[model samples]
Target: MGHGWRTLRRKILTPNVSATYLETRGFRRKDRESQELLEKVGALFLAGYAHAVEASSIADVEARLGTIEHRFRGFAYEGAGMGYGMLDGLPFGHRHHNDDFLAGPAADQIYIVYCGIGWAMARLPRFRWPKAESLDPLLRWLVLDGYGFHQAYFHTRRYVHEHYQAPRFPWPDDESRAYANRAIDQGIGRALWFVGCTDVAEVARLVRTYPAARHGDLWAGVGLASTYACGASRDELVRLTELAGEHRPQLAQGSAFAAEARVKAGLWIPETDSATKILCGQDAETAARISVEMRPEHVRNGALPSYELWRQRIAEELMSLGGVSK
Candidate 1:
């Protein structure tokens, strides 16, 4: 999938490659409406790109941007769209993970990156998932909600193990890097909590229970319960509550901040800082160092997956091929 994604990125980003791929695939030219719509979406993404960050602090928005891309990729798998482009580097109306905004940049890049995820979503009928209908609101919700923190989180293997880990994928040793960790395990667990905290279900239920609690308490109540059920310790749960506060601001920091706090303050015994770094787009080596330093026991015990070597190899290949650039 990664290799295929790299190919897709090059094909989409390089006009010559794009033409060649289209020719090889016998693809037709996209109509003007499609092109114009793509442009409009790009404009929207650019407009919100700076403020798109949910966290108050950014060492590099690009790092957090990688987190958003990671989260959006997970969202793509779970029968929904994050309303962004493919994280595999296929640009479409999608905002770059980096903070610097260049002037007079090509809008095509923005649209392609931002809308790349939507493009993938459009291909989902072949995968037995429902087609996305007008992803505008969905995408807005995703970025605004801090890249669906809970959704990205639910895809982790630990969540699945806590729920249905036995006899399934990602055995104890492979738990951290299992394929299922990023999709089924993490997505479902996080979705439940995220939905529980918002009025999503209530709003859906409101169609039946008109004049009922308008997505406020009901969502938060369910989110709280889901958080607890997902093995969050009492202190951790309180911390989540504190971050959420009263209004539960539609921002991303609560989750990122909480993750940082848990590890730094020794609140929750995390899987590894490397795993968290992966969420933030750190290369494998950096992630490993952070992980080992943060949790020596996990590293010595072989609890953390050793993907750094493979990641490095892939990164080298990507750099050689110009599939990735600084």
Candidate 2:
């Protein structure tokens, strides 16, 4: 498309900037610092989305995304992933946009990119959803994590307060379909961190309102978001660890995943180090190493997808270390 048309497309496609504001979304405003940090994340995400839809090529998108600060840069790539995923879903656009992005500029940001596609999934019609066959078998579940986060973040009353769960997610077109809701719940768990504005007690209370069975996944999500997003203080993180109790293993597992993501993307910050230590009881490098070492070679083996198995292995490993309870 021409530059003019692309600019128009970007304007039309991107959500209003106000959508990122805490007041606009009715999300909690626990503290000024946390609120500002989360809002900046939203702004960076939108900036990345704009760049992706308007840029002429992947290189252009990469150049624009690189301008984002190191800590927030992954989020921009994530937004770019969403932009490319949206473009790929459009009737007139080539289907290879996400593929090209994953193979190129998004290589190190794969986890965030896959989650970004989930955001596109939330916006795109069900018929236009990216084909399950095209995604990584193990990590594709992260897309649902993205989707769940989108729904919970934007439709908090239903997905969060009401605890609504998608009955049977029809993506991926496989036997693993039944597990889709769990993956999405993990995403919702992540959103709760933002919705609570990084308030440890409030986030925990919200998770408690859900069914006991879902608490593990939800807490895991919280761990991922709190660690990856880095809005909470050392005290808040410790409080979260105390609140997690029996789910600490799952929480540690999620934290480890965030550690790996930040470390791999070269976005590791002081907050990452502190969060990993407090939540996972390991330094960022060791926590990240645990996540890497525990990854299953295959994407599928038993009733659960390899992703869940990978998660299980990580949790198990962490629990064995006595850092988190069994």
Q: Give the whole-model CA lDDT for all candidates, comma-separated.
A: 0.28, 0.91
Off by over 4 Å in 1: 1-179, 182-184, 198-326
lDDT of 1 by residue, 159-244 (tens): 21233332443212233323222222222323344322222332123212312222222223223223212333334433443343
Give the lowest summed-lDDT range of ten residues in model 1. Answer: 99-108
Q: Which regions of candidate 2 are displaced past 4 Å?
A: none
Residue 232 of model 1 has an lDDT of 34
Q: Give the TM-score of candidate 2.
A: 0.98
Candidate 2 — what's its lDDT?
0.91
Model 1: how large is the Cα RMSD against the reference?
19.0
- Residue-level lDDT of model 2, residues 1-326, one tens digit each, is 79999999999998887999999999999989999999999999989988999999999998999889999998898899899889988999588998998899889899999999999999999999988877888888999999999999999999999999867778778888878988999999999999999999999999999999999999999999999998988888988999998998889999999999999988999889999999888999999999999998867823478889899999998878877774
